[model samples]
Target: MKKNYGYARVSSKEQNLDRQIEALTNYGINERDIITDKQSGKDFNRTGYVTLKNQLLRSGDTLVIKELDRLGRNMDMIKKEWQELQENRINIIVLDTPLLNTEGKSDLEKKLISNIVFELLSYMAEKERIKIKERQAEGIKKAKEKGKHLGRPKAKYPKLWEMYYFQWKSGQITAKECMEQLDLKRTTFYKLAKDYESKLIK
Candidate 1:
């Protein structure tokens, strides 16, 4: 018998899987057949997804997902996986995009149309990602122009920084001892020392 399976994913452990689970269940997939992963969709190497693709799913089986992004965030990877599934003769049903469903697409013309649509969607997705990154870069540039600090705030210098720095510079204290006194790592201590010296020079 042809089995129906559902796959769902969340980007992080903090996100709940309840909505995906409910959607799959409502679509008539058995709760047991609904596989889920609490990990980013950046790749298809997710534990749940890998297990389902390699072991559970078979030819003639139907695989349902809430959306294309649920499968993966990488457009190229998503296209590759989709082609592999097609070669395996697995029917894919994307609930959010009905046109992507391949259940009733048996004719040559229909298949051609589906392929064209899939390629267009994949291209659009990739383009959208690029646009988002461009927007973020522009925003950062604007923020910098306005003198707004970017990235994590610099750590404050330790209370005994002046004393420890002078001792370290004068060779009276070892670098290790200075770091221990400031309760800082080697990198942080050196960074602070460099910044302090730069300020003194000014």
Candidate 2:
């Protein structure tokens, strides 16, 4: 009475889930037993994945995915979840990695091999993630050194800022009045005033 369940995932809406779905279906999994999520693999909090794990899947059921990373991106969390599934007696098959498959094998040697392969792959995945982050940090630092803006560009100073700033500073106009005249928020007005004053001092 073991059922075959397939899971498919795409990190963003722009990416198509068709490839994963096709692979699952071609593997002979029933359409009803295939669940998909259009969300990041960073976590297992996705609705489709959660529903499969909590409600649909049961002991002795086989869970198949196109790849290990489809389950999650975090190596530690992936290992924890894999252990949990193993403890629950649920089988897993990664289509891209035959060595990691836990299906149709009851032999101790096979199990040991699978464990070794899983550990090595998980470690490599985590290391790759760390390298990517380091590369990103380095790129951002270089961009900053080149005088490129990182985040959103600073808002441009409104026209008539000099007139409004002088009036506000001399108490000829209230802060709210200056903001209203310039159609700017109080914070923006104050920030522009400070920048203007700094320019004058320089």
Candidate 3:
């Protein structure tokens, strides 16, 4: 008996995989037959996905995915994996776009349509990724031009820092105690305090 397997992936743990799993279940696939990866699609080194590839797949089994790009970030790798699954007699059904399924259609028209959709979606995904990177770069450039710090916001310690400095100088409070009272983390407190000391000496 052939089994239907579903694959769902998200780039990070913060992303919810429930919707994808729900869709698969609604499509009649069993929860036991679904394999999920909570890792980046940028690479094929995902733990759950690797296990599914090595052990779960068999000839005549159908593999389901929400989208083609969910399989991998690299276009060439995505194409290769799609071909590999097909060559193994495992059909692919993209839930969002059923026309990409290779189980039934084989005519010239069908093939042509499939190719067009694949190329279009693949190009769109890659373009969107690039656009996000460009936007981030532009945002950073604008922030720098406006004299904004690029990383974490600087700590504001108006009275507490002054008190810390005074107590530390008088030997009444240790540096650790000053840090504890300031409620700033060790690294941040040390960095700010060190910079202040350096400037005072100069």
Best by TM-score: 1
TM-score of 1: 0.65
lDDT against true structure, model 2 = 0.83
lDDT of 3 by residue, 64-172 (tens): 8888777776676677677667657777788898778765555564456457656876888789899999999999999989999988787665466787788987999
- Give candidate 3 regions above 4 Å deviation: 40-44, 107-114, 129-202
- What is the C-alpha lDDT profile of model 1 across 13-89, one tens digit per residue? 89999988898899899999999998754453589998999999999999999987776766666777787788888
Each prediction's RMSD to truth: 6.2, 5.5, 8.5
For residue 172, model 3's alpha carbon misses the true position, in angstroms, by: 50
> Of 1 and 2, which scores higher on TM-score?
1
Candidate structures ordered by TM-score, highest first:
1, 2, 3
**TM-score, predicted candidate 2 vs. hidden true structure:** 0.62
Residue pair clashes in candidate 2: none
CA error at residue 167 for candidate 1, angstroms = 29
Instruction: Tell me the lDDT of candidate 1.
Output: 0.85
What shift in Å separates residue 41 of candidate 1 from its native position after superposition?
A: 9.3
What TM-score quantifies how close candidate 3 is to the native fold? 0.59
